[model samples]
Target: MKAFLDILKPNQLIYPNTVGYDWNQVDVNRPQGHPYYHWLQTNQGEGVVNIDNKSIILSKNDGILITPFTPHKYQSDQFWTTNFITICGYASIFFQKQLGEKKYFVLRESSCVDKDIYNLTNKLDSSCDDAQISLQTYKIFLDILHGVQQVSAEGYKSIPICWEIKNYIDDNYMEKISIKKIGRLFNISPQYIIKVFKQAFNISPYRYLTKKRISEAEKLLISNKDLLISEVANLVGFDGASHFIDVFKRVENCTPLEFRLIYYQGADFNHE
Candidate 1:
């Protein structure tokens, strides 16, 4: 049996200047094992991040706080663009102190404002030299630490219902999974599942299904670009492209065409 604790602590890295920091570029096929902490924000692309065998798709405008010693990787689907202020050195210490050896933490996307994240990243980008850059980097690093403390103060835990519903949705996303059916499976009332799941996960069961399905479709679109969007949709369990597009745009904040255009230009690809 593989205990959740069996995973190795992610080796931490603090690269003051990462490769291709300007224009938000990454080298595909380079698999890095070190963990990092960053004030990361992205737009106009989609990708999967693998953490402890759980693949999470980074949603548009999502801000992430990754913990140390967790093996993780990010791969872009198409032309990918992201602006992030990364603090690798001494950064992982804060998360390590808070989380210990735990490999994952799910930070709610609604916890921070978009403008604040962008402003911090912009400051890091405009630094003139290594000394100035490190100072700016350390400043934002402290901000991130402070933000984590605040989130910790809230004492937020992943609602068990959120994980249960998410697992149920992912396993049956290709089927005509319905809330009523889910309600029956859990031996709970349909309305109860709808209400609590929404409150816990901030997404209704149906919406969660659509989001996961489209995430599958995105992988297909990127790897097998020759396939039609409708085909990709069907492959992911959607009945048609129209339904997929409506939901995809809602979550991605852009149409499929626009996302493809931006992500494919400087796309990064990695799989685990």
Candidate 2:
């Protein structure tokens, strides 16, 4: 198994600084008791983390953020791929207060956010220049901190109607969906839906639906390999291939064909 550990340089602005990061398979059965704040996530398999003497079982997509000075150790019975980072500085002080005395908390399955972290890590790891690596590492650290804050704030709350609407769109993004239709189905006014949904998610319902459609279209373009842009657009609920191309470029900074080539390399294409 490949393992990566990076110790970051001191940064004057962002404190507390990230001391190091670890990404690899774990084989030891011992405590990881440390002094700096740690954010750990299990990417594959299962593990048990003991935080403050409390043993918590973590499976794939499970994560825990531990505060500085917390007593914690983690071990796995089977193959366990994990990613973690240690942080210290003034920023740690801020997180300490926001996290309260309990210090350790589990993160929900945030696939999108986790993808961002993985992409940033890849960028950091692949860069050869030290300056570029440092900049990328700092960006990744900040992104993880912001993600932690969002996840901590949203811990295990009742599912809101807006979330329900979002989930519905996620499941049926290939079908046309309108705010008015959603309002009628949920027994609410379109105006109220727009207002509350925006307040809760920071994006209007229509925008969210468009993003979902574009995301699905991107996935289809990559997975199907031979799929035409028009076919992908139609499959993702776009009115026309041209409009889909426009939206895809606007959201992804690249056209569908370009994205496919970038990920799939040499690929045959057919225009539908």
Candidate 3:
């Protein structure tokens, strides 16, 4: 098996400069809009944005990506809740290219205010370094782009297909899974399964399952001290210890035994 790092593309060049989720929505009177691309979405209730010569009513799952310095203002008529992020990075130009001529995009099904993003923002602490924060921000930015592009291609009414598969994988990672089985279960084609899955998660279903299995295996290895390597492999749906070791090494840069040894004996390094 190729190393897991080999599956990833080069690091994303885009990142969020600032992020806010679950803030009480309020009026903004920016006749001259703020700098940087601002992506704002509604978490609950309703809001409105006036731009060009129109007042756009935004409901649930409605998000707008305001291009830099576009004169605009928004208001919350009632008890509206919202989330927003300001983005900047080396990849700004590339984002603009993908965004095309739209001064602002009314992205459909884009509740960027979802619990996942909110939780991440909540967990961010002072100890997180620039690189760490940037990596996570890049992921959020990429997810936004993915949602935007999906809606742009398939129209506003299109359901989120990738997430269905993702949830399935998450639930059944300990069992054998196949792309064909996923397609049949989800009523999508195999080729389409790969396409959307890769677009959303940046990996194929098989690789994701392997990684998930390895992650669970790591937990079993650590938590259940007396379990044999073969038992760990079996519990994680691996066929045998040797195959499990090969895949575990490819993903983790160490054998399962080595990981367990280092994890338990890591305290010895403190003595040194």
Ranking by lDDT: 3, 2, 1
Give the lowest summed-lDDT range of ten residues in model 3: 1-10
Stretches off by above 4 angstroms in model 3 are 1-15, 155-272
Of the two candidates 2 and 3, the one with more favorable TM-score, higher being better, is 3
lDDT of 1 by residue, 1-272 (tens): 00011212122212233311213434332144344553444454655566677776656655455553445677776665544543453223334543335554444452343444344345445645433344444444444544554454343244566567667887878877788888788888888888877765555777667766865665565455477878877788877889888877766555565445433443222211
lDDT agreement of model 3 with the native: 0.69
Q: What would the per-residue lDDT of candidate 2 be over residues 140-235, giving only the tens digit for each residue?
A: 454554456456436323547767777787788888889888988899999988987776666688887887687567557645777888889899
Best by lDDT: 3
Q: Could you report the Cα RMSD, in angstroms, for every candidate shown?
A: 18.5, 12.3, 12.0
List the candidates' TM-scores in order: 0.43, 0.50, 0.51
Per-candidate count of clashing residue pairs (backbone under 3 Å): 10, 5, 0
State residue 77's C-alpha deviation in candidate 3, in Å: 1.9
| Residue 103, candidate 2: alpha-carbon lDDT | 65
Candidate 1 to truth, TM:
0.43
